[model samples]
Target: MTSPYRVLRSDREDPTVLRRELRRRTFPNPGLAERVRAILQRVETKGDQALVELTAELDRIALTPSELCRTEAPEPPAAPVRKTLRWSLGNVRRFARASRPRDWRMRNREGAWVGERFLPLDRIGVYVPGGTAPLISTAIMTIPFAREAGVREIVAVSPPPIHPVLYYALRIAGATEVYAVGGAQAVAALAYGTESIRPVDKIFGPGNAYVVEAKRQLFGLVAIDLLPGPSEVAVVADEGARAEFVAADLLAQAEHGSSSRILLLTPSAKMLEMVLSRIEEEIETLPRRSMVESVLRDNALFVLTRSLEEALDLVGEFAPEHLSLAVRHPRSAAKRVRHCGAIYLGDYSAVAAGDFLAGPSHTLPTGGSARAFDGLRMDHFFHRTSLVEYTRSAIARVEPKIALFAEIEGLAAHGRSASVRVAGRGRHKENGPFLRGRPPSAKVR
Candidate 1:
């Protein structure tokens, strides 16, 4: 029987065929966008009342204002749970602390102390998905980085009937507030604010398409971690790579949702067939077999490449959120890949490790956005400002250049402003405006 997934040959088929197979599929839905926009406007206008109504209508859960805030925290997670979370937290925090940029100062050509100062945002909101899974790892991946960056406040939002494990993770990760809400409405509340939920400077984490769309619409209104549309993975394997390992990685990504995509590019036709067979056999054992099968049927692919270079080229074209190099020399093979959001080297380095226990946040760019965006990092929480300090001698040294620049730009008054500061004449004693308080006859050319 033919495999349920698409199998394309790069050597024998038209390049367009392979291109078509790799191109991301878009669901045309202006109605969904309009509806999300309306929901945002309603929450913005009606405040807490809109959140209460929308939670019942959309989430199928009822919540009052006080209940929405999750007034009291649950007891600390069980000993084992705490042990596991603390372990992961150490990895995430250590990596984040190492990656976080520091404020730096350097002297310029004019001897001015000019440099960049990094300051953490005042507040941030983290959205952890509740459907299908509680994603307790998301709390560890997102919140600790903000805390490590010294952010003033970190708020978390998830759909109601909060999972005990998720609550514990959020608390341990140092989330200042936890809200029981989800979907576009939750994003709207975080971006626009409501009576009970104060607005935040930025939002982080992943959700369904609606959540992604809401983040897209409210981008300028509030900062977002990245356009994490859906979970996706691309793997480049060689003949020596294990078929079961490749198939398991693909299936794990496919189970994320129907919209998720998985690509397997290799020159090994025999390995391709073996992985397909392994997938067919292994899928039946999974509880989410139907969901995995749907993704496999619609979005999964096993492409046959002419060479390793060809396979690596396709990896760059897809710009997958996660790229696994299952070849014999993963480190060397990874050098050719240019646009993956995260890279998992060797067969033993599973994407799940990066998603859960690895030192980096799994909140990464998706839907081909990895070409330009990066996985979420601690650097994302800070805003940078340039610091410029000039002494009187420094200002005097650059005054001619500054005046000439302003004059060339056709601003005579600007030129005078700079010259007057050094000229120290009349009312321009402290280098005030060059045009102000100048007598008609005393006007210098």
Candidate 2:
């Protein structure tokens, strides 16, 4: 027997490993704030010249204005990928349309009319980071939401892609413009407009540690969608859970990046043994095996809990980016969760589906931000403003009480202002020429 193919269980816990994960979570990159702030100040002061110089220094993609400012993404795709172009574009359009609002209105107790109105930002910048591989979904996930928000102009910045899929995604998602700038410098250009690139009201999309830090620094000058940390997922599984499904779910999140944290909590030690075997067997056939291997060996964990109840408690504590209920009753298990950006019910719906076509926004709050925040939705795009109308009678009815309260607070002008309307226009100027403050009746009445 060549050693039970994947039952390698380690009851041995590493103190060093626990310390490393804890440190990564609480303390972000030191010196990032000062560095990004300095970069933003330089960009704001220098404008397009700064952008051009930064592109050369940071992105390694030197560009003149003509080369960098793309009115539209490049041409479509090759013959094979061309077939899928319309379908992909249509899917993006459909999601965009579905996420937009109808209208809203309401009447107040004063018979004064009031309602909420949603308006879109005039310009938006979308950052799509690519140092290693181009993320086509970066455009897909972000642009649709911006369009749905009714943003008239969408400028997308990426580290210049040689790949066709990224250009294709930008084209399909309907970004109005594209730029070749990359990293924190790109973020600065978007904040304080250059001669070529315009400042945007808000910025959306995700990136590496540097890009994220830039967004954090620029948040006050412009609205940022969310502070994205590393990608993470937690799978809560129980007895009779498919080992293949559990292993696959765990590996999928692990492949996101080396820093992504993936976890599998199960009540059964036997099931844990089964999943480890299944993961080894499946890894050989995977396209991204090396990345998955790093995740499996370093970033992922399989924990043995006292019971299913304890497993749920742990998942709640983690509040990961993506969560899966791989237990017997997935629906029931999902209900037990108090926090998570998105919840996958049962084994059939892998995290991939939610990432791509599912109606909900895939731009989730990560790194336990889910404890207080929520995933991206239409609400993230638009804010509400109240409308109010008060008639003469509405003012007259509340006048007496308003005047008395105003006088009580020593704001005599406030008391008379309310009383003037009801006290007759002639006496208004002289009504207060009585007692030091005038009796309460002379005020409100």
Model 2, span 1-445: residue lDDT tens: 1222222222344534532442234345678777777777778898877777877877677688676676654777786666554454456557767877644444445443445556777888988867676877667777888777788898988876435677767867878888877778888888888888888988888887777888888889999988777788888888888888888888778778877887788888878878888888888887888888887777776777668987787677778889988888888888888988899988787987777666576778787778887876765667566555445555577788888899799999997886776665542232221123222222121
Candidate 1 regions exceeding 4 Å error are: 20-28, 425-445
Give, for candidate 1, the lowest lDDT window spanning 10 residues.
436-445
For candidate 1, write residues 1-445 as lDDT tens digits. 2676788889878897777657554453698899989988999999889999999998788788888998586778679888989999999999999999876655567665565768999999999999668999999999999999999899999988889889989988989999999989999999999888999999998988788889989999888887688799999999999899999999999988888888999998898899999999999999899999999998887888998889998888899999999998988889998888999999899999998989899999888878888989888999888866665666778999988998799988887776776777444223322222332222222
Where is model 2 more than 4 Å wrong at Cα?
A: 1-27, 79-96, 285-288, 400-445
- The prediction achieving the highest lDDT against the true structure is 1
Work out the TM-score per prediction: 0.92, 0.83
Report lDDT per candidate: 0.87, 0.74
* lDDT against true structure, model 1: 0.87
